[model samples]
Target: MSAPNVTKSNLNFTELPFNVSDSNMSVTESLLYDDEAQEFDNEEKTWMFGAPLLLVFGTISNILIIIVLMRKKFRKSSWGLYLTTLAVCDTLLLYMFSLDSWLQIVFKVWISDETVAGCKVYRFVSYFLVHFVAWILVAVSCERIVFIYFPMKAKIVCRRRTACIVLGSIAFILTGVNAHIFWTFSLTEYDGFYYCDLVDNIAELMGPQFVIIFLWLDLSIASLVPFILMITCNITIIARLIQSDRQRRAATSDGAQKSSTTSIAIMLVSTATMFLILTLPVAICMVLSLNDEFTSTGNNMDNLYFAKRIAEFVQQINSVLNFWLYCLTGKAFRTELKAMLCCGRFSRTPGVSNAYVTRSTSATTQVEHKPKDVKTNGQDNTVKKAQDDTKL
Candidate 1:
């Protein structure tokens, strides 16, 4: 897109919030191209068409996490509540991006009808929710770390209400601060699509010095701070897990206990991986946005468009995979999920195929049989043990 036409005096539309139009303000012709505009239209359609799947899968996975965690027994733990919060955050992500995607898909551009106030609200909510979700994941990882380091303390510290309060505060502050973006963003119509742009009228209002300040502020608050906090927490949690086995070896002598710890580590690692994958691309994009050479080209637009789509896809995959990964690796999650899913099966045949049964049987059989020729024996033992455990 060509830069919006601006009067010489109004060349720097960097105003935050909205600046009242002055005589100096003048419209600049759009920087849009005949060919690139067509490509942008096509990309919008592709994003919109694929968005429903992301929303559907993301919504369903988060809902399942909530349902699975809401059981009477499951609710007794703090992690269950954290999972519920995580699900809610994931759902909100889908909800916000869904609107943006659908708008782009249907209109092939941003809608110009929406006022700057409304656009600001949308941006604020989306940005706040993204940050809130990232911090919540950090909280989850820290909670797990606490569980590993001080089990008793974790029981007291990782309360649901406390998490809610902390997360809510973070969301509120982030949202309020991000509302500043709206002051700078004004709607412009290009090829029938309305886009919120900071480079236009608002930048002119704020002037060049204020614009530079705004850029750095945005980078620090939105990207640097959150990234540092999340990565630090995740790395610390991983470090704790690595040390946990050696630290607790004497205390937790049972095979099941050791295995459970390993699984918990895997679950945390998996969750962290999702956040890393999604955020890393966006972070790189943000850095690239500051490059004069990159932003000056049509290629910058392509790079940004692809990066955002990939990030969305990564986030959707993360939301969907949580249940499966937790179920596959964590005995506790598997047990809880199964009970939530097929309550009747386990209800009538109590303890059948439960974590304890599976873990114990596998351990006993492994000890009894030769390692090289143990496949058949292990299978038989697991089945038989499951049956016996159920009968008891």
Candidate 2:
């Protein structure tokens, strides 16, 4: 009740789920709760065992994104900048989440529950990053929409400067918004063990209406609004892409443009779709759990919690999947990835004799030696055009 009871033999401390008082609970209900608890443990093990894989995978994948995007080809691309920032954020978010989860399950060390400051800071940091990442997805989505719908002005509208400003604004605003979590969560003790949770009298402290409003607000900021934007953007992008495909079909000279549009379409749709599928159930769980939080005796609480844990695990998979998505969907990304993996043994200037040309013509290099300036400019323009084409 006042956080999960430590002395209760049937109970275990977890930072991820909220607790309800066991007063007047039925034996059947207790058994049901224990059953749900077992299921959650199994779920935890599944993700936990996969944790190291994800750690290696998510780290290398996100790092690849960062490294690939930071290359000279994408240096001036707004979307490239956005994606690089996203990769960095995902790396941090994944580390924070996976490490906490790993520690909680393996060592049974709950950092948030260990100290009052730890409780608040942990919540604040994690919540801030979650909100931050969601909106970054939204930001990229909006930029993609702009690129698709308003291609002529995309360069003007979506610049690296603009991206940096947008990212800074998001971080600043979300920091202010999630800062309340520091005070909202307290290190609480029940039967000699600790939990990071709200006070039992939270309703009395903040008023029931305020807490309700806050939860709804939290749901909106963290999930609902972004989900709506993502779906909307996906729809708009698909339609525009269809129109572009038809138009490009009639034009013979625009073969390269067609390829670019296809790649962009795949990139946007795959990323947004992953978010939509994974986040939907999390939002649903939040909606279902809203009313139950106010009740002293939790009704169907185990079911709600089961749903929540499942949704959370699904959502987390998104962070690790983006690099693969880009690799699969973007031909250019695959080319670059291949080139990187092969260590440039495959790189050669088309139509130019390698022995006669003493200079490397690959776009990955930043040196502007006079002999290669022409090749560099040509590559830069091609990359610029492709970047412009990808805005949609």
Candidate 3:
């Protein structure tokens, strides 16, 4: 393939792959732009293979969450409503920004004409949803923290109506932020492919410094704040659980207190574990992006690209995995999942184990057996009866 003529108005490129042969070229389309040189074979293989997996897992898991929550019996809780909405948002993002873009990368084709409108829509959807996912996770963490620390207040504070309003408000704000992307870039045909790039008019106005600042600002809000909040909330939850266990041990040597404390601890630990596992890879990616070496356009580009992809893969896996944590730690979720899988045959009272149920039932029967005369005698008879029962 011969080099395209360098017009003064066009952006210069040093080289492209030889396979970009003479094809039906359009003057109105901009050169297909990649931030780094095309390592199509590697990039294609990764995104092509990984994307479908994300789509399958993300779709199935999120749908299951919606299904379980929408069941008539489980529809009342605010947390259930919030989780369902978050799953829906994640499902949309996975399909649009992740699955669709990745397929395009694999096919080596742009989805549409690289017009300003197309650019804006793509950037807006991608950027806004990316931030939206982070914020939604933050909301989830807050939900969990509130439930753990202030169960009574959480019931009142995070009701279904309020959750719906919060989620809607988040979507609106993010949509507005991303709407600007449409006005900035224009389509140009260069070489043999079409793409949208910054119009010279707009690029000159913002300058490189402003662009860098914007990128960092974007990173701070989407990544940094959410990461900090998740870590802090998870840590606090863990601390609360530990303190609860200590108090339970000191106050009650009884099995019921121990059992309840253990249940709460398990739930907190499992939630924290999922969050840490999912977030660690992303935090590492963010740190790597800051290093000048990792930000370079050549080999570093391939490394950083794949590194970010790995982070995203982990995040997608996280979405599916959290439900499992709920399954493992939550008696309610486990009962519900079992009931769903096995129909009504598996349906049972939540948190009823044979041994614990027997014990609790026996205790209740004992309480119901007090004599009529015991009440008339009051404190002396109560003490005497307790001593006689202990002797027996």
Candidate 4:
């Protein structure tokens, strides 16, 4: 039996054999191939046109975030620490995924699929970083809850060192959890192209039931649990903010709290909301697509593919929006950004001194009026005042 000469030009499979008794097995071989070249080519056009723009803009935004967050003023903030870490993650994601997309579009190859080592490393890092991003949001929300509900404890608990520990722990834990990807995915060559995809031999090694359980467990931990936690934490923070607003308003109409905390709360809430929206579709599609019964039908395959693409694009948009959200919601952030952009000339702008005085006075007033004795914890008070001044 001779093999048919398959090329890039012709993909027609109608002439392929339909009987198992056929001596020429090229048609049988072609029949087994899942031809998605045309679909991928269309997606490549979209990636080529859009990915470069996102890569450039996202890179610039995250760089600015890092610059602003690195300043001594903002660096002391625990929230600022988390944001800085997130900015780093976003920058890495842009570099990694955008380059991968460009290579796929232009070269018709995935570098990660070229070798077993590349496949394992790419899958492991990609999964670990993604979940790390989600968990960081969770951590940020938890910090905000503490700040709003337990202000006194927040002063001691939410330190830069504490944040670093938390972030490092998340990286370590997620890295360990996703280590199985090193074995789950391997190089699969089909139609002269290699893909880093699941090893079906897993079913033979660990049984199909184990594979199904693993998929479900991964989906639950990666998306479902984190999504729920973020939502719950953000909701509680908002509720506390509202309660505090009402009490403060009733006590003194002129006692306007500085917009710093309010602005940060708004930004975090918006971020969490975006995370939920962008990630939910991907989670749902993953669950459905992984089901044996659903995939075996082959009817909803195109719809599932389209849904996953859209969901993934939405998720990528999440990495680019945080910087803009800070600019939009935080007046302090804009001032710092302006200063950085103008080489410190913006600090000499008229009324800047008065704004600084008003902010300092407001912070002082809040600290002095507190029921707790500031003299007992003067150092904590001073740190808190400095943090308040630098708030975004």
Q: Which has the greatest lDDT?
A: 4
Q: Distance from true position, residue 375, model 1, in Å?
A: 39
lDDT string for model 2 (1-392, tens) is: 01122222225535425443557777786776667667777767866786677678889999999987776556666767877887887788777767666776678666667678887887777777778778888998898787666554664677778889999999999888876666667866675666777666767777877566777877888788988888888888888777766665564455454344356556857887887787778888778767755433554665566566667667777889999999887666676666666665444222111111112211112323343333455576555544443331
| Clash-forming residue pairs, model 4 | none
**Tens digit of per-residue lDDT, candidate 3, span 162-252:** 7778788888987776555566545655566556554556657766565455556567656777778877876787787677567556655
lDDT of 2 at 219: 83
Provide TM-scores for the models. Answer: 0.69, 0.78, 0.70, 0.78
Local error of candidate 1 at residue 142 (angstroms): 2.1
Model 2 residue runs over 4 Å out of place are 1-10, 13-34, 253-262, 292-299, 348-392
lDDT of each residue in 328-362, candidate 4, tens digit only = 87666677788667666454221222122234334
Give me the displacement of residue 40 in model 2, in angstroms.
3.8
Q: Model 3: runs farther than 4 Å from truth?
A: 1-43, 112-116, 185-192, 196-199, 205-208, 249-276, 279-287, 290-297, 350-392
Full-model lDDT, candidate 1: 0.58
TM-score of 3: 0.70
Candidate 4 contains a number of clashing pairs equal to 0
lDDT of 1 by residue, 1-392 (tens): 00112111111123323343544444431232324445555555566676777777777787887886776545655556767787887787676666555765565444333677776666656666666666676667776666555544554665666676777787777777666766766665554545555645554677767655655555566457666776776787678655655545544466234444355556766776666775676667666666777879766756565555555545555556676766776666677666556642453222312232234324322323243324454576555545543442
Q: lDDT (CA) for every model shown?
A: 0.58, 0.67, 0.58, 0.68
Ordered by TM-score, highest first, the candidates read 2, 4, 3, 1
Better of 1 and 3 by TM-score: 3
